[model samples]
Target: MTSAHPTASRQRASAPHAKEHHMRKTVRTSIAAAAAAALLALTACGSSTDSSAPAADGPYTAPAKDITATISVSNWGDPGDKAVYDGVAKRFKEKYPNVTVNNNFTPITTWTEYVNKLVTQAAAGQAPDVINIATEGVELGMSNELFTPLDGFLKNDPEAASLRKDIDPKLLEGFSKDGSTYLMPNTFNTMVIYYNTKMFKAAGIERPSDDWTWDDFLAIAKKLTTGSGANKVYGFAMPYYSFGITPWLYSNGTSMMSADLQTAQLTDPKVKETLGWVRDLVTEHGVSPQPKGADPYQLFPAGKAAMTGAGHFVTGGFAKAGFSDYDILPWPKGTTKSTVFGAGAFAISKTSENPALSWEFIKMLTDQQTQKQWADAGAAVPSTKTAASTPEFLASPKHADEFYNSLSYAKPVAAPRAYNVLDPAFMRAMDEIMSGQDIGSSLEKAEKDVEEALQQ
Candidate 1:
C-alpha cells in the first residue's frame, strides 16, 4: 500500500489521467503502486537493437582505490521510497566507498505518466544502469528488452545466495517471467486493518477482540462512524481500489476473475451480495465515507479520522505526523481471514559494465543487516520471518503484532501475463462500485476491458 502505482501506458486514457481516485495510498507500485501492479506478472523479453550483445559480466574485484561512478539507480520515487531508501544508498556507500549512487528517483506525483517516460527512455536505449522496476515497468522494460536478466550472476554467488535466502521468495513470484528470474527481492508492505483506538474509546468498542468477524467489525464500525458532508469521519473505508477490496471478495472465496481471465466472476449475485456490505458501509449504514481526493494517509496519522485501511509502510508516516497512538489488527474476517500480501526485490542489469559488481550491490541490498536497517527504521515489514520476529523490532516497533499477524492470511496480488494494463481499468471499476453502482455490472465491464487490453 505504500508503493507507487504507475499512472500511464503508451495509450493514455482519453480522459484526463488520474493517479488516485479509489486507489489506496502508494507513493503512487514497487517503485509506487502502479509499478507493483505492473510487477504482478512477469515477461521474458530482453533488450532489443543491440540486444544480441553478450552480458559484460565482471570479476569486479574492488579496485585498490575504488573507482567512483555514480550508479544511475531508477525508482518510482514516492514518499514511501524516500522513507525506505534512507541509508540504503548510505549503506551501499559504506560498503563500497568509491561507488557513488545518484538516484534518478521517479516522482509518484503521477506514476502512470512517470512509467511511460521511463519505458520510452528504456526503449530508446537510455535506461539508467540500475532501475527500480515493479509490475508496471517490468512489462514495458522486459517486453521491449530493456532489463538484462540477473540469473547467471546470482546463481553462483554465496553472499548473494544468503541475501536471497534472507528475503522472501514471494517477491520472486511477483517479478518472474515464464521460468526466468528478473528482479532481486527488496522490501514489502502487506495490507492490514488500520484502526483508530480513539474511535474505540468514543464508541465503547473494545479494541479489536481476537477472532472478530466481518459482522462484528461492521457493528462496531457503525457506532464510531459519524458526520455528514466534508465533515464526515467514516468508520471504515473498504479499500475503494481493487488491490484492497478484491482480496476481501477472494478471501471470502468469491473469484474476482474467471480461470481463463476472460470473465468477471464478481458478476454473480452472491459476489454482489458480498461486496454490498462494503458499499452499505457508506451508503446504507452511513458508517464509511466515499473515497476521495488523493489518499487519507495523512488524515489517519493526523487523527482526522478513526479507521483507515493501511499496512506497515504507513507506520513511519503515522509516527512522524504524531498519530503514533494506533494499533494494527486483522482485516475483519468474512468466510475466512484473508489479507493481501506483497513483497519487493532488486534486479541487476545484464548489460552492466560490472555484473559482478551489480551482484555485490544486490547482495548488500538484500542482506539481513541491510534489511534490518530498513525494517527497524519503520520503512516496511521485512520479508524474512527472522527479521519480523526480531526483538529490536517487536519489543519497540508500533503495530508490530498486527503487521506480522496479517502474514498468516496474506495473499499475493494476482497478475496475469502482463500486469501493467490490468490495474487502471480495474481501479476505474472499483471506483464505480464504491460509488454505489452495481458491483456485478462494474466487474463485468472490467472483465471486458481487461480482456481487450491483454490482447493488445
Candidate 2:
C-alpha cells in the first residue's frame, strides 16, 4: 500500500495521465514539422533512396574507438528512476568517453500511456534512439515497427552470449516474436502477497506460509478483519489491476485470454469461478475494501489492511512509510502456486542514427555490474541470474528469494496486439463483478467485447 518507486508494467488507472497527454500532443506537432524539414533535406541531397538492406548476420564485434555520436534514451520519469539510469549512463560513458548520451524522461504514469506517446513520436520520425519498454507494451511496440531487431546483434557478439547466460531465458523469450528478438531484458518483477506482521499477530492468527491454500487465506482474512465502516480494518485489499487479478486466474489454471493470445477466455469455467471467489471476498465475507478508489499501498502500511498483492517495488515505499515489520509470502495456492510476472527491456529504435552505438549502450546496461547496482538500490529484481543471487539483492528482505523462486511458476502477461483494447475491457468487467454484478453475465459480456476488439 506504500507508493514507492513504480515498477515496470505495474500501472494503476487511478494514476494521472492527462497532463502527459497534452504534452505529447504539443511535442508531436513540433516533431512532425522537424521531420518534414529533414525529409526535404534528404530529397534535395538525393539521399532518400531505399536503404532497407538486411543487417549483417554474424557475431558483432565492438568498434575500437572511432564512434562519436549523441544517442537518446527514453524511460519513465520517476524521481528515483533518473538516478538509476544516470548510473548506467556514467558507466556507459566510461567505456565510450566521446559518445554523448541524452536521457529523455517521459512523464507518463502507465505503460499504456507510455506506448501511446512512443507511437506518436515514432509516427513523427522522432522516437528516441533507445527506449525502455515494459512487457505490456513489447508486442505493441514491435508491431508499430518502433524497435530494431536485436537478434542479429545478439548472434554476432560473443559478449551477447555471456549476457544471455546471465539473464533469465524466459524473460528474453517473452520479448521475442516469430523467432526474432526486439529488446534486451533489463529487469523483472513478480506478484507476491505482502502481509502486515503486526496485524496478524494482534489478531492471534499465524502468518501465511509458502504453501497455504486459498481457503486458509480467506479464513485468516476473516479473522484479521475488525472494526466497522470508516474505522474498519480490512483483512485484504484486492487490486483492481490486471497484474493482481491475473495471478488468481493463473493459480486456478486459467487466464484472461488463450495462450495463443488470439481469443478471450474470460468465460472459461475456472476463470469465472476465480472471479466469483474474489468477488465473495468483498461482498459475502466483507473482508476486502469496496472498490472506491482508495490507495491500498497507503492503507496497508497504515495497518488498515492485513494483506495485499504486490511486487518488490513496494519495499521502498513501505520503508518510507516507517512500516518495516512486514514480510512477504507466495500467493496462496489455488490449483497451482502460480503468479503473474513481467520485465522491462531496452530496445533500439529502427530510426536510430547509430544502431551499433545504441547496441553497445544496451550491452552495458544489462551487464552484470549494472544489474547489481539496480538490485542494490532496490529499484527492481535484476534480470541477470548472478546479480539476482548476490548479497546486495538478498540483504534486506529475508524471504526475497521467494520472488526469484516464483519465476519458475510465473506466467508471462498475455500481450496480443489488441491488448490495449482488451485490457481495459477486462478490467471493466472485473470492476463490475467486484461491485456486485452477476459474474456469469458480466464475464459473458466481457468475453464478447474482447473478442470483438481483437477482430478490429
Candidate 3:
C-alpha cells in the first residue's frame, strides 16, 4: 500500500523490474479526465448516502448460503496470489457452496496506472464488485466513490465484530474515512533493515540492536563496504522509492506532509537533513549505491549489497534465490524509532449488485484462519496479532518478530485524499535530490507543487 508496486510477493514475482514506489506518473490523460468527471458527478449526485455515512441503523444480514450469486473481485495477481486465492476460495466454497467469486487480477504495475485502468473500466460498466485496495489507492478510491461503507456489517454481524476486535485498531483506522469503514484490513508491511548475516560476520561487526542509532548504522555500513567498480559490494542498497525512503524521513521526525494531510512538510529542516544523509550514503560515504535506480530487493539477496530497507515480502524473493543468511532489525533511531507501515484491504464496490454476499466474502478474507495461512506464506505481517505471532511466521530469519513489533512505533504510510497528485510531486523532488540537485530547492519546489495541486 505504501508502494505503487504490488506489496504481495506474488505480484512482485511477475514484475521483478517494477519500481517499488508509491503513485507514479502513469495515468493516461484521457482516463484521468474520466476519473475527475466520475468524482465530480458522484459529488454532484449527493451520493454519500447512509450506506457510506456514519449512521448504522442495524445489522446487515448476509444472504443464505444456498443462494446463488457470482461476484467479480479485482486484484493484482501472479501465480502465488492465484494459489492463495484458489485455496481461500476452496475453503469458502465449503460454507457457501452456491456463491462464486470471480477474481479479475491485473499484472503488477504502478498504482497510477491501476487506478486509471479502473476508472476506464468503470466508465465502460465493467468494474468489479470488490477490489483489493492498497493504502496508496485507498484515498483515490474513496474520493471517486468507489466503495460502500461496511460499518453496518462490522458493527452488527457477530463474526465481523469478532474480526474487528482481533485486528489492530490502527490498521482499521487506515481503512476508515470520517466515521465509516470501507474496507477490512488484511495483510500489512513495515520498513526494516534487512542485513546479510554472512556479510556482517565477514566484516567482524556484531548485529545491531533494536535500539541502534543512525551513527551506529553508518559505521557498520562503512565497515561492510569494500572493493570498487563492477566488483564492488555496497554495504547498503538504498531504496529510492517513496515506501523505501519514508522510513528514513519518519525516523528523522519529519514527513512529506502534515498530519492533517492539508499541507506539505517536505521543506522541513529535518526532511532536508534526512535527504542529504541518504544522498551522502551514496555520494560521500560510498557505503550505499545511488538511489536513482537501486534495486535493493534483488541486490540484497544476490549478495551484491550487505543490507537494504524492505518489508517481509522480500523474504519470498530471497527464498527463491536460496539466500537465507539475513535477518531484520528495527529501523535505526534518529529522534525516535518511528518507521512507515502500510496495509491492504478488501473493499466492496458501491456498485456491487450483491452487497450482502460481498460482506460475507470479506468476512471470510479477514478470518483468523485465513490470516494465519497468509502469515505462513511469509509475504506480509498479518493484521491480527494472533496470526502474526504464529510459529510458522517466526520460523524464518531470526527476529522476524521485529516486523510485527515495529507497529508499536510505526505510522501508516502517508496516503491522503490527494495522493495521486502528492505522491508524484514528492517522488519528482526525491529523484531530483538523488540525482544531485540541491535538497532545499527541490523540496521547496515540491512543497509548492503539492500545495497548489491540493488546492485545485
Candidate maximizing lDDT: 3
Q: Model 2, range 1-456, lDDT digits (tens) per residue?
A: 001112343222111331332232223211221222222222233222232213657546675565677888866635556666788888888888888887766553343445455555555555577777666656556655556788778877888888988777788888888888888977777888988888888777776678898999999999889999788999897755666677899989999889878888889999889989988888899999885565566677778888888777666555554567778899889999888777777887666767788888898878887777667655457788888898767766678887677778787876555655656677788878887788889888878887887786
lDDT of 1: 0.56
What are the lDDT scores of the predictions, listed in order? 0.56, 0.69, 0.71
The 10-residue segment of model 1 with minimum total lDDT is: 6-15
lDDT of 3 by residue, 1-456 (tens): 333222322223202433432222132111222333343333333323333322476655668879988877766534555676777777778878988878766544443455555655665665566677676656666766677888888777878767788787878887788887888877888888989999899878888878999999999988888888878898899865677788899999998889867778888999999999988998899999876665676677778899888778677656766778999999999988998877767887776777777777777777887788778775677888889888888888899888778888888777665666666677788788878999999989888877887787
Assess every candidate by TM-score: 0.76, 0.84, 0.86
Model 3 ranges with Cα > 4 A deviation: 4-57, 110-117, 124-127, 143-145
For TM-score, candidate 2 versus 3, the one ahead is 3
Name the lDDT of candidate 2: 0.69
Model 1: per-residue lDDT, tens digit, 1-456? 333121110011100222332232433332343453332222222232232112335432333336665455656444545655655777778767887776656554566666565555555554455656544344444544445676655565444566667555655665666666777756666666778776777678777765678888887777776776767776775545555665567557665555434444546665677777677776788776666563446455545566766556555555555555667777777888776655555665544454445555666666677667656766466666667778876753355766656656665555443344456566677688777687877877877776775576
CA RMSD of each candidate after superposition? 6.3, 6.1, 3.9
Comparing candidate 1 with candidate 3, which one achieves the higher lDDT?
A: 3
- Residue 385 in model 2: lDDT: 83
- List ranges where model 2 is wrong by over 4 Å: 1-57, 110-124, 143-146
